[model samples]
Target chain A: MRARLLEATVELLVEKGFSGTTTTLVSERAGVSRGAQLHHFPTKNDLVVAAVAHLTERRGEELAERAAELPTGSQRTRAVIQMLGDHFAGPVFTAALELWVAARTDAALLEAVAPLERVLGRETHVMTVELLGADESQPGVRELIQATLDLVRGLGLASTLGDDTRRRRKILDQWALTLDVALDKEKQ
Target chain B: MRARLLEATVELLVEKGFSGTTTTLVSERAGVSRGAQLHHFPTKNDLVVAAVAHLTERRGEELAERAAELPTGSQRTRAVIQMLGDHFAGPVFTAALELWVAARTDAALLEAVAPLERVLGRETHVMTVELLGADESQPGVRELIQATLDLVRGLGLASTLGDDTRRRRKILDQWALTLDVALDKEKQ
Candidate 1:
């Protein structure tokens, strides 16, 4: 029943935004009684927060999981980067983008997002540190890693805002090239 | 009357989202007759497109104006960067974010955002090109510019969740130091 409500929450969030989504709507979509919702989550904010936490935890785990499966080397590094892309991307990204928009003025929503974004930042920083530990002191490696993150986030923004796919692809490819070069430079 | 309706469009949009915002809501908010709205913007899409376009053009002009008044050299570059931050940022950024969210399922919105984004892209690109015209090929210069942008956008995302003023200042300071190094390298 909790899982059912979780799925319903994701659906409504994608369809309507954070503010527009309500517990009643979630219950209706989940085909469950209002009492059932109250039994699980006493408040609408409780349901939304739980849903967000669930999504956030699961997405980070998935990224780390994929990163784990890759052979330990540059391949692992690349995989981790790719994992980052895939994890907070597309429809999932859209959901985040929606919540981010709402969080601007909605204090409660902003509070809900803090822990989730913190988890994401930690995952990103830890994964990046592991990947670039060998080159930690290189003049520009740290900067590049930080900048690459910036690029990824920017691309996510551009992609979501109907920017040209071809342009986004080109930018990502260039970023990959720049990273590979910087990593290689550190080796030399 | 048109300006009054545009103001209401923004109010309703801020209160509701793309889907929730409606002509009736706008009319009620503006205290204008529905017929007057139709006279200005015959459809909801038409009204929103007008509002977005108005906002974009205003931002473009502001960026230009800010870029003009700044001192030359690094000061100028930093000012331009700040202008870019000021242009596509703040509450408008969240609204811009929603447009991206809306574009996924709404073809009309997807269509609507393209030219708007293009204009935004061009506006920023023109200033960047002007600033970097002499030596854009300098290693890390473009990357630094991109990094600055990413940092700004990152702050947008970070601030959406909570007060991220410290992180934002760190990124901006890093941008300044990094840009100085990269630019100095080009001169050498």
Candidate 2:
């Protein structure tokens, strides 16, 4: 029932946004009695927080899978960034964006989101640092990783804004290439 | 009278977004009579369209001003990206984002926003070519500019989502530095 509610919440979030979504809609979408939802989450904020946690956790799994597919150091770094781009085009991101907007003023969502963002930050740092292995503690690796994260975050947000699929693909490819160049610069 | 309402509409957009904003609240905020609002903009869509146009025009002027202030080629390029970042942080972007969410369902807003995006995109491209002293006719320059636009767009959206100020700054610097690197590579 909780899993169903979480799914329903994401569905509604992608469609109606945080402010527009309601417990009634979530209940109807989840096919559960309203009482069941209340029994589990007790509040809408609780449900949204749980959904975000689900998002980042799922991201972690995807990152692991992408990393597993890569045998080379450079390949691992690119895969991790690609995983982020792919996931951003997926469900968790679509819902998280709405909550992020509402979070500008909604203190509850703001407080709930910080830990999740930290998890994402740490996961990305780990992925990038691992790819940099021998140079894990290099002077500018942190800056590079942070830039990539920000760029990916920005790309995800912009991708949702308009119908520019071609442009989106180009952006991703270019960033991947730029990362390659940045890595080469290190070797030089 | 219309100007005041448009100004207030921009403010409400930043605070509440398109879905959250309403005619009555805008009328109330603008200190205009409710009947007067209807006299100016018969429909809410009209008001939104007008506000978007107002924002787009203002942004063009703002960009021109920013470009004029930069005395160096590199600074000029950074200024343009920074302009994009700043533009995304306020009413211009809140309106764009709101339009994006609304566009998911409303074809009208999707149509309404294309030209605005084009204006920004072209401005970015022109600024990039001018700053880099690169040939726009060249395929690689187009790729580089397109990627830079994505980075700026993404950075703006991330910042809007409350990416930390320092972190966002680093991303901006890295973008400029990456552009420089890409240009240096192209020159060779």
Among these predicted structures, which one has the highest DockQ?
2
| DockQ score of each predicted structure, in the order shown | 0.33, 0.50
Once fitted onto the true fold, the runs of candidate 2 whose alpha carbons sit more than 4 angstroms away are A71-78, A131-136, A185-188, B73-76, B185-188
Poorest 10 consecutive residues by lDDT, candidate 2 chain B = B179-188
B81-157: candidate 1 lDDT, tens digit per residue? 55555544465665565566666556786787777777766666656767544356765456545545555665565
| Candidate 1 residue pairs in clash (backbone atoms < 3 Å) | none
Model 1 lDDT, residue B34, Cα: 87
Model 1 residue A185 CA deviation (Å) reads 6.6
Residue-level lDDT tens digits of model 2 in A1-188: 88888888888888777776899999999999988889999989999888777766766787677667766644555555667777666667778877777776567777887667667668776776675452536555567666666666666766676546676666667676777777554332
True contacts kept of each: 0.27, 0.46
> How high a TM-score does candidate 2 get?
0.88
